[model samples]
Target: MMGHGPVGVEALPRRVSVPAAPGSCADSLLERDRFEWRLGDPGDPATLIEQFLSTHDLPVTDLARPGDPRRHGDGPCGAALFVSAAAGAVLVDAPPGAPSPAAGVPDVAVIVYGHGPRHHPSAPPGPDGWWRGPWQPSWTAQQHAAAVDAARTAIARGDIYQVNVVGHAAAPYRGDPLPVLARLGGLPGARYGGTLAGAGWAIGCASPETLVELVDGRLVTRPIKGTRPATPAGRAELLASTKERAEHIMIVDLERNDLARVARTGSVRVDDLYAVRRWCDLWQAESTVSASPADGLGLADLLRAVCPGGSVTGAPKLSALRHIAALEPVGRGAAMGALGWVGPGRLDLGLTIRTAAADGDRLHVWAGGGITWGSDPAAEVAEARAKAAPLRTLLR
Candidate 1:
């Protein structure tokens, strides 16, 4: 592991690697060199991202053909992007060379890890680990439950079918958050887990849901909804609940529509439906949807189509977004966005759920679930805590 300097001071040297645990998805992408740029265009990050990648000779995958093996974790990452829920994105090139910063602080940093023998200087002792401080929630359980009821009311009024009510929690930390981040990213069932850091802010991701991925000319997304504890009874309850199934189906339909916009005619299909998956100690329902890309589709076009994923939003994505803006206490920040590697003719990005950010002074975390008319307000509050507990536990 490399030592971290004072936040926002020194630039990260070229390559970065996270030592992968046994059977871990957080593999190493030994980058040759890197360059960092911050795109302020929140409304149109796709265009900026596409342009940046093109200018830097990194790009969208168009050459992938049918039957090409999935290369998500095996190859050198061309670039990695961190898109924030606030409508902005950060791009990092993954070729070779020292990091060349653009201008302001980056929202999230990019680090690619690879295998083989290597050594790095250890971080200083004082700023090395996190303190077990009292974490604070942006919304109390009552407040979060009230938001859930509000969503249910909206559903009753026919304003929206379902809305994801998010809650935020934060705590001050005295040390570098890298170790906590690494441990969070290495947790079991983290299909999309890793640490990406910038000057002032950093994200430790342990997302199990796939926001979007493209390989062999096919675009794929796995929207996860409906959660329960990860136990025999929890799995049974999750699979049996009609309400959970309904929530899962709604997001599946929404995802299908999102992909249909850029899919080849009549090529979209649901590969799986409501499969229960384990993420640490939780059981969540996930469904797979895929489509062949339309001819000449680009990365910018794809992101514009399915970004701010429906599972995190709600049915009728735009309206749900409007409600979310009005109800949430704080901005979603790095959570509920997209994070992962982007390579030419191949891309793999995960939905930033179960993700946390550290901004020099404080560490931030967000968690929530889809709210439907049948949702129980109290249960919803507990669900959010259940989702956040793992990350919080790892932080200590």
Candidate 2:
């Protein structure tokens, strides 16, 4: 699928100077050889974003607060925050979170561009970086299967329709993570890809889902659910699977409702449903939901309507969140939140799946799948493992 000029994953055109007024969305640190990032609160995130869109007539980009709101102090998630004007230009005040030399993963949210030696960035994970310590799974296969069973039990009782179950693994590491980010950001069909860092943390993402996008006065979102390994047989199976299709439709409907919350009346619709798209080695089922803003809607309002993304959280969002909180061992952190760019009359952000975080000596990676009535416990466990395989291979 194509878009208006170079937007979303296309990012900025290289060598473009930072605008004198710096209003162009794509003209920023991301397209450069190097840039700086750090942590500092931008007042209330919601309010700051609103001003960028309303008062200043500028754009503000950022990672949304994760589903588990309790992890707020981990460091301000200004990972992708870029403002159009100079006053807001210096988004973070702390020291820059440049990549360390050890070659680890990226964890905390840091902006890209500024105050670093310039060089042509490597196109992939330069041979040096990989997890060198023991890795521990937050939930082993048996444990994850138990969680899936619990979700299925709830479904039988009509307590929920579908839910996403997730697990994480951590390993010790050190040094810079930019090389890993470079490799991940180059993944095939990665629409929302980039890297950001902080004092001891950095986040690298190669996501395919657009949680929300507003451009040319229109709002858009691409929700992805079904997944299958990239193979002739696997692809065919994904297209014919009844359970995957049903779960996908339910989430698509949920996304339409979410977009409608902030959309102009009578302006919401599903532009694509059950669309098959390739993300790295997997073939995913995706759908697009779009609408125009309702009178008096703003960034804060749009975020409240949809933040964690339906495909990751599940349908009947609140219920699924409760289950996820009780079932998963740790919060989602910077992964599965949101990332991308923001510009004048344009806003684009994607779910941070296929994401990894590096904090000091620890590297974290997470993966999971949607569970429905037809979902098999064994299959669900396998799915999560399958999703994490690529990252594990790279880090190993």
Candidate 3:
């Protein structure tokens, strides 16, 4: 941060207290003036990522011990990729044929990027201001209920145990999306949150769940399933609800299997399960699964193993994904995927649930809930709205 002054953006005046949150929560972690990004080439997205890592060789830590430090928390130099819920991902950072900068922080040094420059960690920026824009729901409540019912039928027919059904809603904007992300992400309680601006497109993510994080050779993923409004009664209800617990455990088991596929034999374990955590106004049930990589396993393999996270896709992963494809009305653009940084030997990406992709005047936001046999279509729809409320308000 010392020599690394603001690189990508213009320097701003000294920070004044922000009354409202910024558009992108990642802004809270990084200095709006300082940071760098790369765009991808015509090569396959995953291949491009691998190429960048191999060429840059950013400083990475040793095999992670229990309490080792984490690197580049929301820095701009790393890549911010958005994979589709249906299957592929787009690298919104670092394209080939662009000015390639030196990879910073290749050592085991801890990098934190929310409050200031990627190199400098300072107080997160606060709100300047922006106008809420017009929003339109892609699907009516009835249509969403129909989708939930369809998933329920699939469950009853023994085709799947649980399926996450998501819906999309987009708002038209007139200005830059960076500010929108700043305000939305700045609201508070955003984990694995950040923003990435690519050519002709940008994504603002305030995702709370970590799809995967690599540190010191330890492969980890925290699958978040159940959610309830943040309240004393809501928290108790979430913990007591047999349905939520069952749905959460299903994803946990699925995640364990997903990890086992790439983890060193007997290295995978559930570090945390049925853990109640707060994110914005929701009480979420999150479980952490970690393992050492099997000999020769790399990031690409891990991404494939647990993508569009099981919590979002549901149990019997492949089957759930197929069902999701058949059921969803519109494609999940930036939501339901993963977003965050990939640098050096470390990668920390979040499940892109509470995220939006901004292309020109359109901001596509998506929300969904897992549909189980006991799921109530109306309630599921409400839960989806609740999950999406923060973004909707920001747009309003």
Candidate 4:
């Protein structure tokens, strides 16, 4: 297990540069090489990523914040990392000649990078029909409600503070799902929205929460917890709900702890607390936590300290993980993990909530929220559907 160490004063990387403006008229690097690895692969995946960035002179520019830029530009030559909640990760946009990160257990984790400038990744012309669905869920509404009840019981037993309960739904598809999935990046309030594809899988994300971001010596994370519909009544109800506020604070505290592991001793602090924000048609509560990173904060160490974000895993994260493993019907796949850019001294990964994954056979989506003793099983079920509604509508 990776240990959480000191977060003390440190200097920013000397070689780092601010990413290019959000939108500029320059060609972007196209895909060049592809690499995949699994959980038991020989090399440490995170370390390999650190090495790749170190040896390459990647450009530093492009969609720095959440959501896509209006146009393409001479963005940084970086790779896209799609880490599964379990299993491993895939790195896309890596160059063919880049150092081989790892070998063995070929398919589970993958990385594909870009070389010279290629045309922007517009939705290409493909088969006319792309998908089919009345989307089947892995867990029925009753089952999901039962899981919520179980979590509440665990809370009652003093076994955990809070645990996020997720439900999975999937729909069959016939052609490429990339174009439609790519559209997810443009969803309203998408702080970390975009699409990434590899050999047999792809991920479309419209996540509004920031998992972690490092730029110009400062490191930050924004975790979202409570949720309600985007309506006048909904906003009022969400703010009035003591239960929602309590759950939101627990995750905020968790995030502060996560960053403190790699932040300067007194640097970790909450910038904003429980600010209501909109994502699609939902109103959610979010908090911002940031810190001055410790010297020599490598990607491997940083990720180990905070990989599966606390908002998704729960407070008392380890205990929550055990509950999640026993309760969830299926693996989270790419949802609830981290997705975003990584460059020499920069990183921005969003908590992959409101995210979907597409295998050749099916496109999968996962949605849920934090569960506390005060949670209502029936409301939980409805909330999960409400969270998934936008993604489903877009895919349809």
Which candidate leads the pack in TM-score? 1
If both were scored by TM-score, which would come out higher, candidate 2 or candidate 4? 4
Model 3 regions lying over 4 Å from their true place: 1-44, 58-78, 88-132
C-alpha lDDT (0 to 100) for residue 115 of candidate 4 = 30
Q: What is the lDDT of residue 307 in candidate 2?
A: 67
Minimum summed lDDT over a 10-residue window in model 1 is located at 93-102
Better of 1 and 3 by lDDT: 1
lDDT of 3 at 25: 33
Q: Model 4, which residues run further than 4 Å from truth?
A: 1-26, 55-76, 87-127
- Better lDDT candidate (2, 3): 3
Residues 320-393 of candidate 1 have per-residue lDDT tens digits of 88788777867777788788876545478888899887775678888999999999999999999999999998
Q: Using alpha carbons, what is the TM-score of model 4?
A: 0.82
- Residue-pair clashes, model 4: 20
lDDT of 4 at 118: 34
lDDT of 3: 0.64
> Which tens-of-lDDT digit does each residue in 1-396 have in candidate 3?
211132233434322212112323333443232122323224544444444444433333222321222343443333334454433322212111111111121101112233454233365443344344666787899999999999999999999999899887776665555655645666566775555553355556777888888766778898889989999999999999999999999988998898898777899888888999988888999889888877666555666677668888777877777777677766676577666655444467778788766664576788899999999999999999998989777755
Model 4, span 183-262: residue lDDT tens: 67778998777766554556678989888887656788888989999999999999999999999999888888888887
Compared with the true structure, all predictions reach lDDT values of 0.71, 0.61, 0.64, 0.67
Poorest stretch of ten by lDDT in candidate 3: 100-109
lDDT by residue (31-67, candidate 2, tens digit) is: 2222222224335444545553333223333222112
The top-ranked prediction according to lDDT is 1
